[model samples]
Target: MHSDPSGSTDRIEKDIVINATRERVWSTLVTFFWVDEGNLGTIDPKAGDRFVAHSAKEGSFPITIEKADHPSLLSYRWASAQEGAEPGEGNSTLVEFTLTERQDGSTLLHVVESGFASLPSAMAERAVSDNTYGWEEQLDALKKSVEG
Candidate 1:
């Protein structure tokens, strides 16, 4: 887990090794990250597709897919601050996930969420702090979901 709430480094990076093949890890990552249990609809992710991630506790957030490279990478832009607002250059952060296959068949999962520096200083700091913790929790769950 790495984050700088001082606005100098406006991104969060997390890496976890899952005891699973890249294919299985990729499947779990795509499914778990994109379609949460509370999500309202299904999505076959691809570049340019738009969707809303509905969280019962946090509310809905609009997301736009930037790139979806099968089994290796997926990147998206999300506006997390305002509920139901569309993702844009000024209001959104880019979230990217990269998967690498290890020689031992375990998968290395890396995630980075950036663009916080563009947001208001207070918002940027809070977002970085919040997401730093969020990613750690989320990745742990993902590892369990894939390994199980």
Candidate 2:
């Protein structure tokens, strides 16, 4: 549902209709995959939890779980690992995942990531490119996880 008007990384969006219930999809988007499956990186799933994951060849960056809405959405600020990183530097993108129930019992999952401009020049481009591919692949994985 994003216009992608600027065609910049600022307007990135990934949406999918999973064959699971809205609640189930929400759980996948929030808890299980992250904590159990190690989706983003190896970090304990907890608010204020912080860890480093080597990404984009930039060593380890920060990952903090800022908020979680069980069975609906989960959001957090991800920090980049490169040196000279600002306090919030390498930290951009308010990523959100929303789940809605469809008429036929399917679940509509919406993913939006904003504020990519905050990343360092090199990492910003790399992040967008990498995530673009990653999201698509993850969607397929999600489908199988829920449908299987």
Candidate 3:
């Protein structure tokens, strides 16, 4: 977790070591976002690709791919304020996933979501708390999905 002195932005980060190859972990992440989430359409895994993630529980939010490095790093920005607003410094949060292959045929996956400070103080606090728990569950699910 990261916080600025001005409370303008906060970060939530979680990492997991998966007993699987980098390719497997990456594939699982793609599926988790595109399939299980049922929000992202056909992902091209390229920067500038625009997508939407919709869920009954989470609602719909627009996302823009910020960076894509095959089997290593993938990052996107999601609107955290308004549903259809463009993801940017003040209106959205950036989610980044980094995968590192280990010598033991496993991979370490790290996820960081930042930019909560742009939102209202109460909303930012709630999002941080909610996502803290959400990330934990999601990472556990990812580990199971990839390791099993």
C-alpha lDDT score of every prediction, in listed order? 0.79, 0.62, 0.77
**What does candidate 2's lDDT look like per residue over 1-148, in tens digits?**
2333345566369989888888767655554353234445322355666544443434444556666666676666664324324236445556677777899999988877666666555666666776777678777777777777
Local accuracy of candidate 3 as per-residue lDDT tens digits, 35-55: 237444334478998767676
Model 1, range 38-129, lDDT digits (tens) per residue?
A: 34433457999877777776677878899988889989998766667888866789999999999998989999998888877766777777
Model number with the top TM-score: 1
> In model 2, which regions exceed 4 Å deviation?
1-7, 32-62, 80-87
Q: In candidate 1, what residue range of length 10 has the lowest lDDT sum?
A: 34-43
- Model 1 CA RMSD to the hidden true structure, in angstroms: 3.6
For all predicted structures, in order, the TM-scores are 0.88, 0.70, 0.83
Model 1, position 78, has a per-residue lDDT of 87
